[model samples]
Target: MQYPIKKNSLVDETIRTIRQHIRQQTWTLNERIPSEAELVELFGIGRNTIREAIKILAYLGVLDVCQGDGTYVRAVDDFSESIVLLNRASLHDHLETRCLLEIEIARFAARRRNAEDIQNLQALLALREKINPLEDLEEFWIRDRDLHLAIAIASHNQALHATYRYFLSTSYEYTKLFIQDEDLAEPDHPAHETLVAAIISGDENQASAYARALLMPTIQQLEQLSTT
Candidate 1:
């Protein structure tokens, strides 16, 4: 509320500061934001400028503007608004983004993981391996995603961990699309096993290589699907 406001672009600056406040949890998710009058006073801006900023954020899915009630925080950020398109993006595109996220996650995990992290990852991977995807794809997918999530958590990077956690929910739906359409075989569990081992051993390059190795087959499958 006490942010410095530049004169020329009051609306944009108001929007930016409001977003910062939300990000910092000054205004929490589902919590109603300050009223236009309060915001006008807090920001030293006009009612019109405050209303316009709130309207723009509401459009971006970051805030929910109610009829009689005040505006409320809808999501943590704007990424929630674009999830529909992200889920519908090409299989190759999804895999490409997954590669970028997971590869870095693996490297960070390798460098940052502790004994407890190793133990947790091993347990998740074991549970993942035991579930035959063909028998129970949903259960198998959940376990698989959990193991990757453990690795992301082991990275000890809050921003990266949060981003991956949010992204995985979107990717899971699209991943199911290819698995159903292509009748894909069981995932390369051994490759994942090696990736976990690399992290435990603190070998960053090996961890990253294993992570990429695990995803390469899916990329190739998507390419083949496109060609056919």
Candidate 2:
């Protein structure tokens, strides 16, 4: 359980070693790996370092940290996970899945959204617009995802919300391919504003239309790319 210390980059080294163990099946899927205290002792590192490393891995979906419960192995290997994601579905597949989920999500959000959900969606929309994608494209994408996630949460369907989040995480890498720097330079995403307005006004049909509108261009470009 002990790993050789690299001294300078304790946190990064710990993270790499933990991932190595997971990849090697030293920790198996769905199994609770170890407690924070045990990991600190096993790694011979400070608790803070171990905690930080675990935090990063949890964010990456390699580990799942439950409050009061031990961290569990959510995935076996990062590289193999990415390979499987690549092989299991194409970008077009991810987009089609998005369309299927989002249309209903928008419809239900429009029907179910309360004051708080509307406030949150509006706030996220404003925050998303402020980000100049030309300067920070990745951050813009994250914010955009957060907004869509908020809309899904507004649907009041826990299963649908969880499923959408799972698919969103899986499709994230492929979603990045749908836009380029030049494409994002101007970034005319006015449909987002209207979509929020539609949800706020409880207009289900309009909300669905705007949701599909937001994605249609990307789908078309993907089609163009696949052809070429």
Weakest ten-residue segment in model 1 by summed lDDT = 178-187
TM agreement with the true structure for every prediction? 0.66, 0.59
**Candidate 2: lDDT of 196?**
87
Show model 2 residue runs off by greater than 4 Å.
Answer: 1-87, 181-187
Candidate 1: deviation at residue 150, Å? 0.1
For model 1, the superposed segments whose C-alpha errors exceed 4 Å read 1-77, 181-186
lDDT of each: 0.86, 0.83
Candidate 1 lDDT over 1-228, as tens digits, reads 455578988888888889889989999999999898888788887899888988898889899999898789998878543686786788789887888999999999999999899999989988988987768879977998899999999999999999899888877676576567655432478888899999999999999998888777778877887899
lDDT value for model 2: 0.83
Clashes of each: 0, 0
